[model samples]
Target chain A: MDEAAIHGILSRLLMAGTLPGSVKLGEHRLAEIFGVSRERIRKVLHRLGHERLLEIVKNRGAFTIEPDLREGRVVYEARRILESGMAAHLADNLTEAQIARLRQHVDAEADALRSGDQPTWLRLSAEFHFLLAEMTENPIVQRQAHELISRTLMLVKRYETTAGSACGCEEHRAIFRALAARERGKAVKAMHSHLSLVETRLRPTICVEEGPSLEEVIAHEIAVYREANGAALMAAG
Target chain B: MDEAAIHGILSRLLMAGTLPGSVKLGEHRLAEIFGVSRERIRKVLHRLGHERLLEIVKNRGAFTIEPDLREGRVVYEARRILESGMAAHLADNLTEAQIARLRQHVDAEADALRSGDQPTWLRLSAEFHFLLAEMTENPIVQRQAHELISRTLMLVKRYETTAGSACGCEEHRAIFRALAARERGKAVKAMHSHLSLVETRLRPTICVEEGPSLEEVIAHEIAVYREANGAALMAAG
Candidate 1:
């Protein structure tokens, strides 16, 4: 596999919080799993470390961060500040088409919730913030928002119960409604409160002690990644 | 000098807009100037490239970016969004002591302006936003704000005439007043308009063709860095 493919699989696996906090990602093991050289795996691991997705220890292998509630508070507060500003900006600046697109996204979130598709609802709920960031059409804002949102994803995956994610769809819709109405203050308030609520929803869960082996998790992530890129992989080959 | 010192000097030099955009930063040349190995200079250059401070061209060398007015607009819009959120957060969160500190800082700016100390006023003006970011007490917000603020410093250096920066003190005082009064919406509006006014003040100036040689700029930056770090360096030695 190429470095980007390896990085992508590892990034998703890490962000999904599937691996236990105690599991150290050994370069040799990753190289064997990906059918690549150790050097290549090492490079990708260090890159992920730089991105703060993985914790790189000198002489020790890479490990997943065990983000505590304190860190979660910091991350959520950051999102509140950034996305609130984003909300206010979009309130004043979102175009008619952009508003319609937001409405469609919120509707999709509602539909997923109604259909009892928990996974889809969760993903859409996260994408709602990302969509707002994109609509800002500012690359810097998009980049900053992407980093904070990605960090929160890890936090959400680890701390939030499955039931906790269910109510987020409505919160996202509220934000969308405020933005659509061009109510800047309301939109900012909605976003800030929604994120604060999400932060409050985080409950400490025991890291899975025996859920899945590292190898099993890696294989599953690789398979999911390949399936998602199947058509592109085929075309390239 | 260490890699960080080298990086600091180069960063300040580049951000100061002393070098013409067309000047290529050759590794060997920088190595000689800093009395470091070419490899060390190469590393610092690439690091700066990663930070978007310098552009590293394939098979060529690193060069300063020539940010146009269009790029300035995007950056200012980003600052407005992020700092507006910051202002809102501070409006709700600034403690009495923090408010006092802000008051003192604004007073200092006004004093600097009255004393005809344009340079001090300019530096204090930029630090006002940074101070607000630091007051947010959120590392993520601080990091994001620092990056955006640093980018604008470059834009301000390149495009803003000296006279244009003089009026920013009052705008900053307006933001401070709103934040001190804990007026969330007013604070956000003050910040947004202040940044918009700053952006509108940007004017295209011809890149100086013969102001100073690259060596002179680097030497001057190094001297400034040394003077700033004199105490720390002396302590370490």
Candidate 2:
């Protein structure tokens, strides 16, 4: 099996941005947590660093990266290349079961947004796309999409200009409707528009008070929102 | 500036694979050739490994991977996603200058094939797509396109696919023509057809030769391909 423990820790930490940018990750602590040898830990970190998830200096320990605007551009560009095509493929190939799953995904995203579970929303939003790619049945494309998604997450953390909300529930619902109807062209067109909105919402800055990353604020808000709304979160919103 | 040292070495190997996949590389010799520390060599090997250029292993060093049948499928899937969209983008945005450049690229590929300069042909063919992506002036899409191209090259090697001789030069020319007219739909369709040729030629094999992996093959070919092609070698094929 793959080295699940190390990868899981790295993936979660990187996704959550718990390992803040430039914050040196201590080897011993990571080893203790993962219960793996430093060698294995080093291997995984080195791999993640190569993926642009972490920055590893020779002497210094690895730290999460704070991608610049250029990188932000890269992330979006990758999305344009991958997700756009994926949207078409998904629309053309979406099964009834898949449509239900997507509805479920959108529901989760809406739930996260309603509950103010920014992290959950952010995560669910990404997973929504990732899951769509998975349905394409191409591992290579899936890997490429996953890479782009991770990079996008990293970039989102840096700039904090994600689409206006967890994923416009209405848009997801609309796309879902289009897919369910087997209208490939409509689904593809809808996907493009939806992605455009998502991309457009990702403007330049997060905030003036930007005490925390937009991710931090949104994710924490989502959690609070979740606490207040429970099932009513989406309804209340 | 980009470090030409590792890239230079790597490109040589990859281009060489287009002509011939059977090559061997020695580690100590390569370090001496590059005049770098073994550590640097290891890092480069590891990086290429991630890119699937060099199949470096814990004990077996590295080898330039020749894509078997399974890998070829992986490669083609990536092409389907990236190139199809690239063609569409090109069709929508092709300028006169861009069209001319694309023609020149096709010509160069033909010239290399005619001259039996597989390395140059290989580099040019790969760059042609990236150059088209660049014309979009979208570095983000360009970069993602780049990653896909790199992986595709590996697949070509794995499958021992002969992407065909300059016999199909007119096809490339035709695709360029469509791109120039901003026939977005036509261009996308052309790219799909073009990549289909590539996929068709790829020789599928279920065998994974039990020996030094595709990484070391990459190391040697990286060096050799560059030495053979000189300036054209600069393209990150």
Candidate 3:
């Protein structure tokens, strides 16, 4: 597999937070699993390390980040500051079409929640913030937003319950409503409160027990990745 | 000099916008000037390229970015989004000591401007934004603000006249007053308009005729750098 494909699979696996905290990822084992060389796996691992998705130790291999409440507070506060700014910008600058698009997205989130699709609801909930970032049409803001959002995903995956995120649907709507009305202060407030509420929902006492082996998780992630890219791969072939 | 010292000198020289547009930085020439190997020069050049301070063309050498009005618009818009958020954050979070520090800094700017010290006023003016970013006490926000601020410095150097920046002192006071009063909306508005005004002041027709040669500029930067680091070097030696 190409480096990007391996990186994508490993990135998803790590961000999914299925691995127990501080589980070391042996490069040789991963190379064997991906049918690639250890050097290629090492490169991807180091790239993920640089991205803050995993922690690399000297003389030791890469390990999944152990979720800490202190770090979670920092990430959530950063999001609040950034997304609040985004909310204000969109309030002033969002076009009619952009507002309409946001409306459709919020509606989709509601539908996913109503239909009892937990996974879809969770993904859409995260995408709501991403959609707002995209509306800014600013690449720099989008990148900053993406990094903070991805970090929150890891935090939420490990600390938050599914029901906690379900409640976030209303918060998203509140932010969208404020933006649609061009209420900059209200939008900023809604976004700030939404992120703060999300942070408060993190339960640090909830310890995850045994999970599937690293090999199993990597295999599942690779399969999902390949399936998503199947049509493109066929076309390329 | 070490790689970081080389990088710092080159970074400052590039951000100073004293180089002619699209000026190629020859590796061998820089190696001779810095008394470093060509490989070290190449590494610093590539690092600057990654930071968007310079552009590295494949097969060709690294070249200074040609300041474009279009790019200036994007960078300014980014600053408005980010720094506005920063202002809002500081409005809610600035402690009494931080507020006092901001007051002192604003007064310093006024003193510099009234004394007909354009250079000091200009530097203090930029530091006002940096001060607000530092107040956030969030490293992520600080980093995003720094990158946008640095890019704007490059733009301001090439596109804005000195008189335009001199007018920015009052704008800084407006932003400071709003933040000190803890008015989130007003602070955000002040920051957004301040950045917008800065952007509007950009004159695309302003063309720099000529600058010092690359070697001369590099040598001057090295001298300034060494002077600044003389104390630290003495301690180390």
Best lDDT among the predictions, by candidate number: 3
lDDT per model vs. reference: 0.87, 0.67, 0.88
lDDT of 2 by residue, A163-183 (tens): 466456677777777777877
- Candidate with better lDDT, 1 vs 3: 3
Q: Could you arrange the candidates by TM-score from highest to lowest?
A: 1, 3, 2
The alpha-carbon deviation from the true structure for residue A216 of candidate 1, after best TM-score superposition, in angstroms, is 4.1
Q: State the lDDT of candidate 2 residue by residue for B2-90, as single tens digits.
A: 23567655755563344234344456766766667676667677777777666776687877665556666666767766776667656
Give the TM-score (vs. native) of candidate 2.
0.73
- Name the runs in model 2 displaced over 4 angstroms: A1-4, A18-44, A56-63, A68-70, A107-119, A155-163, A203-237, B1-11, B18-41, B56-64, B94-96, B107-123, B138-140, B154-164, B204-237
User: Which residue ranges in model 1 land beyond 4 Å of their true spot?
Assistant: A26-43, A57-61, A211-216, A233-237, B37-39, B58-61, B235-237
The window of 10 residues in a row where model 2 chain A has the poorest summed lDDT is A206-215
Q: List candidate 3 segments past 4 Å from native.
A: A1-3, A20-49, A56-63, A206-208, A213-216, A234-237, B25-47, B56-61, B206-208, B233-237
Q: For candidate 3, lDDT tens digit of each residue in A56-165?
A: 99789899998688999988888988898899889999999999999999999999999999899889988999899999998878988998898888889888976777
* Docking level of model 2: acceptable
Model 1 per-residue lDDT tens digits across residues A1-237 = 798899899888878876667578899988898889998898788778867788989899899888778989998888888888899899999899999999999999999999999889888888888899999999989988987888888888888888877888888889989999999989999999999999999998876666677888889998988788997879889
lDDT of 2 at B130: 77
lDDT of 3 by residue, B1-237 (tens): 998899999988887778878998999999999999998998788778867788989899999998798988888888888888788888888999999999999999999999999878878888888888889898878878887888888888788877777888889899989988999889888998999999999998658688788889989999999998997889889
TM-score against truth, every candidate: 0.92, 0.73, 0.90
Q: What's model 3's TM-score?
A: 0.90
Considering summed lDDT, which 10 consecutive residues are worst modelled in model 2 chain B?
Answer: B15-24
Clashing residue pairs in candidate 3 (N, C-alpha, C atoms within 3 angstroms): none
Rate residue B176 of model 2 by lDDT: 83
